[model samples]
Target chain A: MQDPFVRIEGVSKLFGAFQAVRDVNLTVGKGEIFALLGGSGCGKTTLLRMLAGFEEPSAGRIFLDGQDMTGVPPWERPVHMMFQSYALFPHMSVEKNVAYGLKHERMTKAEREERVRAMLDLVQLTQFAHRKPHQISGGQRQRVALARALARQPKLLLLDEPLAALDKKLREQTQFELMSIQERTGVTFIVVTHDQEEAMTLADRIAVMDKGQVRQSGTPTDIYEYPNSRFVAGFIGSITSFDGRVTAVEGEVSRVDVPGLGTEIVARSVAGAASGQAVTVALRPEKVTLTRDRLEGPNAIAGEIKDIAYFGKDSLYRVTLPSGQLIAVHGVNAKRAEAGRPDWHDKVWLSFDPAAAILLTE
Target chain B: MRRRPIFLISVLCFGFAFFYIPILSMIVYSFNGSRLATVWGGFSTKWYVSLFSNRQVGAALLLSLKIALISATMATILGTMAGIALARFRRFKGRLFFSGMVTAPLIMPDVITGISSLMLFILMAEWIGWPATRGFTTITLAHITFSMVYVTTIVQSRLISAERDIEEAAMDLGSKPWQVLWDITLPVIFPAILSGWLLAFTISLDEVVITSFTTGPGNTTLPLLIWSKVKLGVTPDINALATIIVLVVGIGVVIAGWLMNRAEKQRDRDARLAYRANE
Candidate 1:
């Protein structure tokens, strides 16, 4: 097997007495877009900074293409970083900004110009060569920053919240554009972002971080479908959780009896738990089906509709189970609904597939 | 609500006259034809010509210009470095002590600084057998000691407002630390350094107390010459010299203002270009 493009081996960073990153180990395949997704102060940005050589790890080592980069400075490393603020030199023209790193590469003037022109064209900023950074709009500045970082043809590109400064509509469009650019260039990209949707849309794999450690690392589908912990399930998306005890285990499925909902739910469990062990069952709102009549399924609970949030394409129903547990059911807002809609205060049955209910042990 | 127009105009006129009357009188007396310093005979440029022709005044003006230029240039360089270091680097063991030492000259009386520097130079001369006498070198050194305090203060404030992330980003893009300093840090602080030089120059040129104590017989500066002339009773030639000095200072002020305006416009243009590029 070929080695990963970049490998982080037990990397840790400490600021004086406080540990900012703790025993983080991960690997990035060549040409893959990996995301470090977390909230503020979760060490995602710190990890990105360490990869860019701005911060040295207090413990462990990092390797890029099988070469150790433990004590190398940022300027000596073959990695480039796009700062969150898009730190473009305000005094230089766009062409000068993009060609800044090439000046030190011992290339001829013509070669430098050709490379700079190619990068500008790549980022779609060729016409603004003579203009300074301030003459451009926010999105244009972001592109210029990206072009500047890529001009050196770095082995790895680090983006610190690349689309964070843009508005909602622009952020969505730019996220797709960034993904396409990464795909086209075949450069290994490590994007650090706090936006879950941004991570889901752009990253081939994500390392969801909390506090200073990776809570979970997997594909977006795996993270969404089978979160290893309650924090991951709650942080990734909205989830309905129930306190329960395991009653039986059979192959890939486990039966959990939840007292509040007054039902036995068969859920997929990766973590082995003996019978009578306390656990939590997580179900996504969109996975639950709501109907007026009682339904027979692996997981079914009778409840009364408490409230309805009418979205354009989907409506969310908040149901109060007979055991006084609140659960949410998302219903499609189409002409032909999947199941009959239950009005507010009406008694209903909520049912979910056994495979959809994930048993979380953490 | 608007007040009475005449009342506002009257107040403005009063304020203008209160400031300009003495300066206008100095200019008027510069052209007086009479030898009696206070009484004017008629308008003539004889005193202006004599002011230029006088050997003592000429030498003093030259000495003052040389000292001011040299001292101000040195002060600006040292102060700018101090400012950049203080603003950009994190605090260390003696950071507070160093910052306090840089600013101490600003509040210390000129007489005290002049006397102390003179005494120190004398002691050094006794110990090392150098600086044979108090002269232009000592005066220039004295001027820089005080003027650098002001320059460092101004430059430090300007550097504090500049973003350090710009320099870090330059380094992140594979530029060395020196390159980042030259390209990003220097350009951002250039305006502050220029203005600080101008301020130091003007202060050194107009200094009197320190110059008086540190200067020898042949090293009298313009202010020192003017002080001596005042003791012998001021003449129309002195008025002519004063007017010329004021005119030169006015031109300097205008030039400084123009340079500051140009720098601000360039900064704005750069910011606009960045904004457009981001779009």
Candidate 2:
């Protein structure tokens, strides 16, 4: 019922002959952590820049808190951006960098210092207030950049690849820290990242982008469980797909007949495909179960394990069905699995519940 | 390897002697008791005292310092502005032409600059009737016209080497263009400006051919005085004055080298720190 914190309608950006962003429309609710996830040159950063007013939309309007911000410059808008390079002024101390925007508001010296102190404390960089950017570590610099962006108490914060500069372990740790900070501030945080795992861990809702367009927008769970398009299904997570034809539609489920496997599989289709329509059935590797003996399930296929990869926590088995379609099955490292391990060239049956498989229309 | 080092050391020593022997001999002759430069009767300080007491030499020295200071300062200011404009604003038309014009003075012969500047000033005076005579003002104007090219080339290279991200970051933090220039641009280029100013000052101070053509009776610089004194035959007083000039130049060179070395060390330290932080 409440107005969305930020609303984008028909936004498009062009750079010479290349169309960077094509008619992107989305809305972020107040206190929501939204992510724009895509690969390189997918226009995720361009969309975020347009939202922050650094880049203007060639065709569309943006509304922030019921006010239009299409023509507003970055300095005038009630928004702040954390650059991909974390463009901290190298000459200034941490305190001066954080207090920079406050000084523009003509705030008193006391008021500016107070806000700066509070922001540094919020980011836990109060002790490094006098340190220059080069004196701090990358993680500390990241916190300093965050403190500087939040010092103005912006209604919206745009982060461009917030953790891309960090190492793998540090990046993973910082993702949670960033989420906690977003929760504490309760500001609308819109993060742009090419890392899907980071988006899954940080965003409440995600818009998967490809070729300057939003392929699908949904919660992480919804996107992972039910992807509307093939791009979204392949991009968000690993998926094993098979081309099939819809046989019948009953209630909310559709029965699909797939070749090579010689099985009738039922899958849930949100797009409402008609009978006899060609469709693709996508299943996550972890959702399918692999066993030496035949297993009872709604959808089942018999195949031979072609390759086995032993991960510490689990084992991944690549199975080739009689129809020559390769499918992957992930088995957890449980007590029973330790006693009996499936080897390569072993006859295996892969089975999953019908609800676990999704029917992708595109 | 040791033999090679010895050979290189001997070559370097020979080079140093070849450059300094003539200047050192002149300085030794400055303290000579005899008026003839080749014959030294005994070491004495009479020539030094007499050189200071000479009215023409004192007046010429003062004129040279005044012209150097004024011309160098004006050239540095104009060149710095031009450098920042060219380096920061890349969209302007004829940018290449502007840059070429700035460097044209550096390669142009001193004779050409002197002749052209004299003609320009003369024509302007005849048309505008502002500068009534060819004196200190005219000489200073001429020195600045050529010295500005050197300053612009140095400052422009420094500006190009500086990171644009710093300026953009300042702007993103709500500072206007002028504020960015004042707080960020100026500070980053301060060392370059100082070095350029020193270079201009040195060039203007030592200039002979251009100053000789432009100077009038009342605007004779120190080099012009030395020239006229030499034409009258070598005098111990002139030698003493030349020795003093050489000492002043040596000290200036040492100080400038020290300042530049310190700046380079600071830049290296900052770069190392930035690299570590990124890691």
Candidate 3:
């Protein structure tokens, strides 16, 4: 957000007795695909609606391109949204639907038609321009919606669960198409989605939210590897957390005694974090390496594999420790379904380096 | 015939008989050549010829059409506005009272509404000196008042089920409020408005009690003429007139039914096509 194109300062929204969004401060850099990631009713959509001028913030101001967006109606704002339902006009053909927003602009009819043709071409939907929305496939309808929103060429674009309506394969293809379109248009995008994988794959940066508050905001890898809170780690990815207390603090590493695991854990510590303070030690599923033999590592625990789920390229093993706490370990199938892979009821050793375990004090 | 129960067949026969018997009897009697409505001397076209030649009946029919058309149009416009207000603005002062009063006409007795309107017209004439005599203008005003209630209720329910996000989408795409209504909302609800207008037109054309209470001497609508003719005696010409009215109404209902069915079929086909296109 060094050269911010859109800034939301201390924005909060309240619906009667329920506070939909807490005090939120965020800035999106120009031409960046920023995502607001959360569960249902976590205020991600409300924040997006506020940015599109559909909903007014109850207590704070929003600035777009250094101009205050206070009291500006949605029709006047230089922002547009691709709705979750698409909301394509049922009475209009695809060509007309894409040209709808241009009716208000001061342009000649020929120029408007040219712009619409270009937008349809950009989304690779020029062949289906004259078809009605329902006459096309779900994937084609989605492209029509994208084409319509981009036809306006607004300064900022908001997308609400753009791929939620499509099948899995179509959604994956649409994600890449959306990214390339954003790259070509150079329009700032703020997407709101409850699907964490979609956010990870499509976002340049993501803000993970919980209960009306932002827990963490960073690049996909940064948030995945170093989540700052227990909620962030659990929400963004699958993690097994244990209650522990800091026993000793080294310069950059700390040893914590966890009663749940019947062992002590070594994790990278926060600067100036004192010993004897209670904290939660979190380990991601894929971060823990599972093997048949015990490793000479700082963090290794023995567990019995209670369940095995094969997902073609990889497998998920639910391991039950001696203390009855189950830990999930994602094992990559390096060898093609060989006997060396761990199976149910097999005893295994799960090990991770000290840098892999995230230490959360809150 | 394929394993159909005898009891189900009897019920179906009973239902159709109950709906169609009265209309069938009326159409049959219209062909009666005798002056007595109950006695059929022979089939003849004399009654139809006399009915078409009557100047009084022709004038009344024309006046009725004019009143129905004007009232139905005015009612639809006002009703659409009221419906949108009630459906969109959730929190307004006196909303409960406003909605309750709007629907009161639907359930109120025609005698009560007619009499009450009569009194109001008299009072207005005394005070404002407008509507100097009650006739076409007074009758149309009264029809619009009651007919708009039906329009409002129909429009309100149709609008409630309409996708609200479409309007917000229009606004987000830089449409003004009026532009959004014209370009998006109204088109989505056009069929509802059309049905409402037709209902209003039918109610106005069929109403007699209200017209009687409000009409002056010269303005004789078709229903008023028929009522006066029936008082003298049920004439063969009146039977011919009634048969024509029933045929027109039956045709209208058939067309409307076909239109609604076709629209529903189109929607189903579109849904199927969308899925097929996916593969």
Q: Top model by DockQ, which number?
A: 3
User: What DockQ do the predictions score, one after another?
Assistant: 0.56, 0.36, 0.79
- RMSD per prediction, one decimal? 2.7, 3.4, 1.7
List, residue by residue over A334-357, the lDDT tens digit for candidate 2: 866548788889998888887898
Candidate 2 lDDT over B30-80, as tens digits, reads 999997877878999999898878898888889999999999999999989
RMSD of 3: 1.7
TM-score of every model?
0.93, 0.88, 0.97
Off by over 4 Å in 2: A243-251, A255-266, A270-272, A275-278, A323-326, A336-338, B1-47, B227-246, B256-279
lDDT of 3 by residue, A1-362 (tens): 47578888999999998999999888889999999999999999999999888889998999999999999999999999999999999889999999999998899999999999999999888888888887888888888888888888999999999999999998898999999999999999999999999999999999998878888888999899988888888888889998888999987799999986767889998864579999988999988999899999899998999999999889999999988999999988878765678888999998999999999987
| Candidate 3 Cα errors over 4 Å, as ranges | A336-339, B1-4
Model 3 per-residue lDDT tens digits across residues B14-129:
99999889778878888888989888889988888998889999999999999999999999999999999889886899999999998988899999999999999999999999
Residue A299, model 1, lDDT: 74
